[model samples]
Target: MQRLVLRRKEFSLFQAFIYKNIGISLGDHKIYLVQARLAKRVKQLGLESFGEYYDFLVADRKGGELEYLSSLISTNVTSFFREHKQWEFLKSHLASILERSGGRLRIWSAACSSGEEPYSIAMFLAEHLPNMTQYDIKILATDVSPKVLKIAMSGMYSQKACMSLSDEYLRKYFSPVLVENEAYYQISDMLKKQIIFREFNLVTGDYDLFAQKAFDIIFCRNVMIYFDRPTQNKLVDRFHAILAKEGHLFIGSSEALTDMKKEFKSKSASIYQKA
Candidate 1:
């Protein structure tokens, strides 16, 4: 199989398409990244070049190929409790959050790749909240890709995927199983029932779909780094609009709200409170 070089012109077309349709800003340095990631797909689809693949994607009226492209270009690298300090912050503030919301909790895990974050939220609340069954708790986990959402809905993880979790959490929240002679763990139904997974595009999806001041916490971590500053500010503004008063927003440690307008007060590094 001949490796298709993603020519500069072809790269520009994809770069524009991604920015226009998906809201991700690809810098010139990312040309190699795009070429490397899309090469396998180009080969698998029997397409000769990235340009042809791009055309096929545009011709995909149902937006399926575009979704696949989004999945490929976008980073979905996530794990359960990826940001340790944020969790510690949440632990310290859980009592006040619960009191303010009167025991009803609503959370949105935006760009929730492969379910670990939302599952972690569910498990965290169950472990910390007293008499968890007596409260109304719902977690909405969303991502742009259906492929990863399907994996999330299955609530199954390989032994390797469960590495970051504690032995107690693994024993309590997951059931060990074998799939084709490989060790796997299934998330308990109690946790699964608390979450609803859906497809969403942070850049292009309708924000009107969400109620104003609906969420107590919004986890849009690690994803904003892919967008340009304007997109990042707009995303932060939307998060601020939807979060309940004093609600917290947790972003990736590598990200910051420093240059953006001060709609949210910095509670900690990468953690902000709606003011």
Candidate 2:
């Protein structure tokens, strides 16, 4: 059988398919990238062309192929304190925010990839909030990738992932371990207990899990670039609705609310406050 290759026409078809199906907009310039990401699947299925692969994906209902598609397209590279300044701001204001909230704190790490961001939030809370044990402090960590969510649930990381972490943090929050001939560190039970991980898609517009509960803080950083302007506005509106009055929304450093509604006011760099 001849090897299958993704051509321009098939790539355009896929761009339309993904945009209509999942709201992911891929430009014509991404043809090479599409080919690279899906070539392996094509070969594995013994497909003759990218069109067949596209059809297979469209007809796939078991979610295996959909999951693969998400993995290929979603950007998940993150680290502990990737945006250090944001963490610094959180640390500075968390105490006052918690106090004003009547000792209850609800934070959401939206699109939390591989858990570092949520765990970092948990650690900061654990360290600064002395009366944290008395309050109802919860961190809702969500992501679209089931594969990444599984890793996040495990709360384990390699030394490389922990390199930026200070020695004190490592000693205070994590315990070193060797699992399956690999060196890694696992988050302490104290920090792990404060977080709840689940799979969620921001594009779905269903937030029933947080229907009754409004968050005091939501860190939806860096995930919106994948979405189009209209989708971005819709998701931001949802965030505004779900956030409590004066709640903080932290986006990626590079992402801005160019077309965002007037309900949110810019509070700081890449930070917005509900109006």
Candidate 3:
């Protein structure tokens, strides 16, 4: 079978389609990258051309194919404790946030790929907060990819995946388990109970679903970089609306809220506090 080639016109069509639907801004230089990422999918679908794949994506009503396209195009590079500085800030200010909420806390790990970010939060809370069971704490971990969510829900990681974790954290929070004749570290049920993982697309997901929810800390790290200024501003506004007064927003170290006008004041590196 001949490999599908992404023609220039097909690239243009994809650039517009991805921008309109996924909110990712693709530059002229990204043509090769997009082709490289999408070639496999186009071939897997047995489509002769990228244009046919594009047509198939548009005609599919359930939107799963579009999601797969988004998954292929978007990056999901993540790990435990990705931003050290942000975690440090969270640790220092956690006492105040807890006091404000009177031991009740709500945290949302937006774009929590493969469960690392949310699980890291749970571990940090367990390690630092005394009488860990005393507080009414819940973490809402959401992602756009069902593929990553499945790995996250399972909480199983190989020794390679667990390498970055500290010995103390691994011993305290995870248990050794056998999976398919190999050893894997599994997150403890105690930690798992604190998190609720769900599938959510930040671009197209409805805000009305969270009408009654107010988050004290929202971690939307590393995702806005893919979006244009307009999309970024819109998302920041939505986050602000759902955040309680004096709540915090944690973005990726490389991303900034400077271009987007918002009420959040910069507290530290990539950390913002609602004022």
> What is the TM-score of each predicted model, taking all chains together?
0.97, 0.94, 0.96
Highest lDDT among the candidates is held by which one? 1
User: Which structure is stronger by TM-score: 1 or 3?
Assistant: 1
Flag clash pairs in model 1. none
Runs of candidate 1 exceeding 4 Å displacement: none
Question: What would the per-residue lDDT of candidate 1 be over residues 41-126, giving only the tens digit for each residue?
Answer: 99999999888999898999998888898889878788998899999999999989989999889999998999999999999998
Per-residue lDDT of 197 in model 3 = 98
Tens-digit per-residue lDDT, 29-117, candidate 2: 88888888888878888887889888999899897887777777777989998888888888888778877788888999998989999
Model number with the top TM-score = 1
Model 1 error, position 261 (Å): 4.3
In TM-score terms, candidate 3 sits at: 0.96
Q: Global lDDT for candidate 1?
A: 0.91
User: How big is the RMSD of model 2?
Assistant: 1.7
Clashing pairs in 3: none
Candidate 3 lDDT at 19 equals: 88
lDDT of all predictions: 0.91, 0.86, 0.89
Flag regions of model 2 displaced more than 4 Å.
1-3
Ranked by lDDT from best down, the candidates are: 1, 3, 2
